[model samples]
Target: MLEIKAVTKKFGNDIAVDHLNMVLEPGRVMGLIGQNGAGKTTTFRMILDFIQPTSGSILWNNQPIDLKAKQRIGFLPEERGLYQKITVEEQILYFAELHGMRRSDARQALMEWMKRLDVVGKVTDKVQKLSKGNAQKVQLIASVIFQPEFVILDEPFSGLDPVNMSIMMSEIQRLRDQGAMIIFSSHDMNNVSHISDDLTMLKKGKTVLQGGLKEIRERYGRTKLYIESPLTMSQLRSIPGVTQVTAQENGLLVELADENVGKVIFEKATANGYIPAFSQQPPTLDDIFRMEVAADV
Candidate 1:
């Protein structure tokens, strides 16, 4: 288990992280999210010992994380950093060795990862020779080639297309199945909601929300309704407790002040006959993220 309790960080007088607490258990994935400069990177640095926290403690299995513990952790930075002059094999093996894997084993592991991530180059190819997407894949390979017990990924899906992003998501789930506690940060709410068992949102330097993904969304109530029916926008807005109604290409988005208002909309829409689609759901992760950010403004 990884634990961070009341962790805070400051650079001179500017607080970068404020009294943050988190726990990550084996085989579970936690998604940390925030806008740029929201202190997500600072929290990762503190855990990596790249910088000391201003206060509070970070522990690995109830003991302070030391060099040995550090070796057990894998980290992929937000910024991609692959040496431009080295062979892919040389680059990944170097990292694996530094993390305590033997050269022969790491070499084999590099071959496996190249195939697993669908990296489109030979092991002998120099890092600079690969395309931007393929280079990112190599960097990800280096981070987890040794099969570290805990992994931290910062924007692993940043620049990928839909196909590549799906590939990365599948590999992340595989890692979690192997009992690696994973913590990652991403700006994409869709990716976060798809893979994360738990979610944490940070703003400025403080946590605005943190909890299980389903639990967090449920807390906001089922206030969003999507329907593709003959009901006009004005008709939806006419219902009591309905706050907003907007026409969409295939449906209408109806915002409710009370979840119970869904019953009224349902009855009225179905009074004539069946509608093509009707989905009443709690605020999505995207919705909650926007609400929190907008609240600050």
Candidate 2:
């Protein structure tokens, strides 16, 4: 397990990360989310020992993370790093050697990874020759070439299309299933909701929310509702406890001040007997994310 206890980072007078606490167990994936400059990167850097926290401790198991432990962690930073002139084989083998893998083993691993990820070109191709998506895949392959026990990925899904995103998600899940502790940061709430077993939300460098995704969403109650019926817009707006009603292509999205309001809407919509759809559920991660940001502002 990886534990971050009351970790705080300061630069002169500014607090980049403020007393953040988190735990990542093997086989679990943690999602770190916040707007830009909210300190997501700072937290990752502290874990990688790229920088030191002003106060607090970061540990793996029962001891502080030292050089040996650091070597077992794989990191993919938000900023992409690859030499345009280097061949794909050379680049990956270099990183693999840096992490203490034998060059021959690294060579075999690179071949397997490239094929598994469906890179369009061969290892002999220069890094600059690959498309953006392929280059990103190669970068991801580099991060995990040695199959580290812990992984940190920053914006792993950025710029990926739906299909490529699915591919990336599959790979992340595979790593988790293999008992590698994983933590990643992404602005895409859909991806986070799909993969995260634990979540931490930050606002201005302070943790505003942290817990299991379901546990946190349940606390907000299932106030988001959707329905397809003959009910007019004004009719929904007039109902008590009805906070907002917006029309979508297929139906109306209703936000109730209380989940109980859903029963009332249901009774009214189904009075004549049949309705196409009625769904009352917890606010999605996207909704919660916006609410948190707005609440702080």
Q: Which prediction has the highest lDDT against the true structure? A: 2
For candidate 1, the clash count comes to 0
Model 2 RMSD in angstroms: 1.2
What TM-scores do the predictions have? 0.97, 0.97
Please give the clash total of every predicted structure, in order. 0, 0
Please give the distance, in angstroms, between residue 283's alpha carbon in candidate 1 and its true position after superposition: 1.2
For candidate 2, list the clashing residue pairs, or say none.
Answer: none
lDDT of 1 by residue, 88-155 (tens): 99989999999999999999988888887889989999999999889988888889999999999988
How far residue 171's Cα lies from its native spot in candidate 2, in Å, is 0.7
Query: Poorest 10 consecutive residues of model 2 by lDDT?
Result: 62-71
Candidate 1, pairs of clashing residues: none
TM-score of 1: 0.97
RMSD in Å for all candidates: 1.3, 1.2
- TM match of model 2 to true structure: 0.97
lDDT of model 1, residue 52: 96
